[model samples]
Target: MTTLPQISLAKLAATATRREERQRLQMACEEFGFFYLVEHGIPKEQITQAIEASRRFFALPQSIKERYGHAAQGMYPTIARGYSRLRGEILHPDAGPDPKEVFDLGIDSEGDRRPFAGSTRFPDDALAPGFARSLLALQTTVLDGVVPQLGTALADLIGMEEGWFPRHFSPPTLGQRVIRYPARGGTCAKHTDGGFFTLLLQEELPTRSLQVWFRERWMPVPSLPDSLVVNLGDMLQALSDDRFKSTPHQVAHSGESDRISLPFFIYPDIDACLTSCQGRHAFRVAEMMLRNFESVEAGNGAGRARELQ
Candidate 1:
């Protein structure tokens, strides 16, 4: 009967002494690896608008949605950065084909640039007005405010100087994905996020889908309105020498209706090197992504093989 903890960013921001906030965040990162974050400064209306826009996009004809696919018009085929149809590819093949559709976008360059930085594909304004704007606004909020605050707190927790973690992100590599999960048995299989961390904005639609690995069992994370789920990622675990757990989690069928969520995967600069207790391994962001794709391909093949047996 383990439960998730909710922490407020406002308290972490305004308080003179951050000892308690740092300790709490560190504990959550070490123990649960996931928590509910409130007062994150993103307007609730903007979140609602983003969710509604996702729903509208999903409701469109499959042909129309396919126009934004990776092979469609203007999308980067090197990475997972475009519209993917339901069961199009298995990210986690252990649970079989994923019963979900996703639209992925990477960092929209603003002056500072990186290899994978670019604008996102979007439908015409007549079809989906304000969709791109709302999504980008929310992403900007996380990049400008929330992520750096967490990074600062993390530096404090790790006994580093105030700006250590934030300074590493001179130009971050980010990807935002809007997902739609249909009412099926399994939506997404268990897996760890493949970045520094994630800011998940999920709809509070009376669904019990998201579960985290805790106490050697899967524990449910309740959906609360106007809040975001902040979770650690594999890179953080490696950077901290496994001091902070990047726990595995999965999404199941809501069974009531389609579920939509927005997850902003935040990463450090592509060329930044990470140091851990093990040693200093130069982990490039693009290389890590390539490994993930390779794993997915292997897993998908293994899944098909097991199905034959």
Candidate 2:
């Protein structure tokens, strides 16, 4: 029944005494593994345009969208890029497939042969004008602008150098995804994200159905307008030697109209290896996705639990 903490990026930056902010971030990561971010400096207009552009893209005919589908174009090997239809991805074996459609894009490169270093498939000019530009702008803002600040705060909490966390993301292997769940009760089964963190932007609708597993129960996450919800991911949990939890969360079908969400996964270089100072354990970035996929397919019960509300 505890509400997620709301942390102000501006306050965290300007405050002379950062001890409180550091403690708050540490506790949130250790306990809830989720929080609301405010005043993060990403323009509201950019966020709005990104959402509107996504709406236009999804409104296109199913056939046109399929032309750019991830599987149709063999984009699965890159981890996640291009379009995926509803039920295309099964993140939880016990909960079945997720009833959602998503368009994914990741760091673009030509020379790097890493698992996730590949070009994104953008919509053609005939589909939606400026769609690629708007989406890219929003993605860059969060990755370049918002992430560094949060990363610095995280490093401070852990007693590492200020920029230690963000430096690993130089030429980051991150991904941006825009998803739509039509109708109510479209469950995105309980699971943890596979990267370092996730920043989600959701439209404020009649129903906000995101739930986080906490304190041995499922808890509802309020949908606040003009705010981004940030959560820890599996890689971070591993990096912290399980000190920072990667809380499991799921999206229950909304009983109202369609629901749209934009979630960006923060990844490091494919070869980046994270070692916890406390536990002396090492986690490779490249292997985390494969490990997570296997767990989901094998019905691993590590992050899964009863969702009774």
Candidate 3:
């Protein structure tokens, strides 16, 4: 029974003397690649609002929800926003499709057509008032404040030159999802996040669903109402030369009642060229991101995960 390391974001953000907490973060990144981040400055109300809004959105009739469905459901063929019904994604191929429904959105840019960019299709305010605003407010706070501070700390741990990460990381491309795991279906299969890192806020019910790979077995990461669960992902693993692994984990929603979790994926500017730590090769952010999504969308993420690992 391994305990996921709990690191204080405030301590990590402390001035020059923050080395101790920074080292702890590095250790967590190296050993477990997952940790509970406390003191992360997100308001309790924002979280509550998002979760409540998600519940309302999901509780709507199927016909009403489908009005905002992905084109595959026969909406906008070019965009991949809005609602996706149950069994829509299979993060781990072996376990088959996930028994989950998801509503996804990125930063709402009016007409930007770049990959993972452009305006989001949100449910009307009359239906779910404050839904988009609440989620985006939470995201904006994290992205603008906590995310950069944490990234700088990690960069220091990895010995990246000053300003290296920020040089090409302006206005990062991000995706946020409000995901629901039904009470009866199987778990979200084992898989690692595909971005630089992820900010996860798990709903307060069924507190024992998330587990991470550690020391040759699955270890539980029970939910803590006040903290965010952070984890390393493939991009960071690549940038750090595998020093920080993107640990594989899965969800096994237990007991009765539905479970919802929000995950915010962070990526660099699409045109940025990321050179490996060892300078082995450089790749464009857009190509890497598209390949990651395309593989999963095509149900071949298991193979892609193997390659990245």
Candidate 4:
């Protein structure tokens, strides 16, 4: 069985050792475009609590969960920062809406009326106690560390200047989705992520559900103990001018019980203009992200697979 390469986030994030680890990280990004991130240093209890809270949220009555549904509150179709009900989001056009339910939260902002920017719609504490806090705490900690450090490392891999990526990401448009894939329904069809990169903590199952297209075959990615799976996204692929790949992946769950996975998507600020890592022409972050958001929601996929061709 093929397993994803394990990259030590501790070493990759360390300033002294990052230079040494960059070659390995780059190889993983280019060859597999994904890896298992070990020694990320997030507390075990925090990961447990976040996953438990997410499970509890999904167990809630549909009516209660819909109280914070994102579609109604979002200023634009692209804003999906709240609870997204099952079968409401379409990631792969052929598979239709995924049978998974998701609750998303991003960096809190006040009065930013643009798409993908605004205060998160948090559920009432009474409705789902600790649901908000646990998830937010996990997301916050990851953002504070990997969102910057890992991002910088990726930039360096593509020859981006030191500290240049952070400038555009000052107040990044990042978000984490706590997803629940129930027992009965269609599988999560093949699709590439639409952002810059993703940090995922998935439940280890007897049957592998998460897979990546590699060497002309779909390979299952095992869930390792205390490790988060990291993958590049299309935006980063474009930024790297395909020097890095945004590998296509999917979930085909055959398990009877519900599964919960936490995936954090990292991207630059909405208003930031991003170009190729080689300093080519640029496009506004908001436009591309919103377009991606709309397409993914509408089951059009990220539509960035064309970049590879």
Q: What does candidate 3's lDDT look like per residue over 173-244, in tens digits?
A: 787888988885537788888778888987766458888878888888888769899988878888888898
C-alpha TM-score for every candidate:
0.89, 0.91, 0.93, 0.93
Candidate 1 lDDT, 1-309, residue by residue in tens:
367877778768877636676677888888888998987888888788889988888888999888888775353333456788888666565566777898888776644334456666688767777777778887877788788887677656655555667677765778789999886553777777778888899888676789887887878787887789998887887777778877787788656688888999888876676665456434766677556655664565211122321
Per-residue lDDT over 96-185 for candidate 4, one digit per residue giving the tens place of the 0 to 100 score: 778888887887778988777777777767878789999889977898866777888888888777788889788777867888888745
| Most lDDT-accurate candidate | 4
lDDT per residue (tens digit) for residues 1-309 in model 2 = 377888877777777746677777888888899999887898888877888888889888889888787655445353367887777766666666688888888767766566766677788756776678888888778877888778778766655566677678786677788888888766677777878789998887657689888888888888887788999887777777778888889889666777778998887777787777676567787787656645544545223333322
Q: Tell me which residue pairs clash in candidate 1.
A: none
Clashes of each: 0, 4, 0, 0
Q: What overall lDDT, based on C-alpha atoms, would model 2 receive against the true structure?
A: 0.76
Error of 1 at 46 (Å): 0.7
Q: Any idea what lDDT model 4 has?
A: 0.80
Q: Rank the candidates by lDDT, best first.
A: 4, 3, 2, 1
Could you tell me how far off, in angstroms, the CA of residue 36 lies in candidate 1 after the best superposition?
1.0
In candidate 1 the C-alpha lDDT for residue 253 amounts to 69
Error of 4 at 40 (Å): 0.8
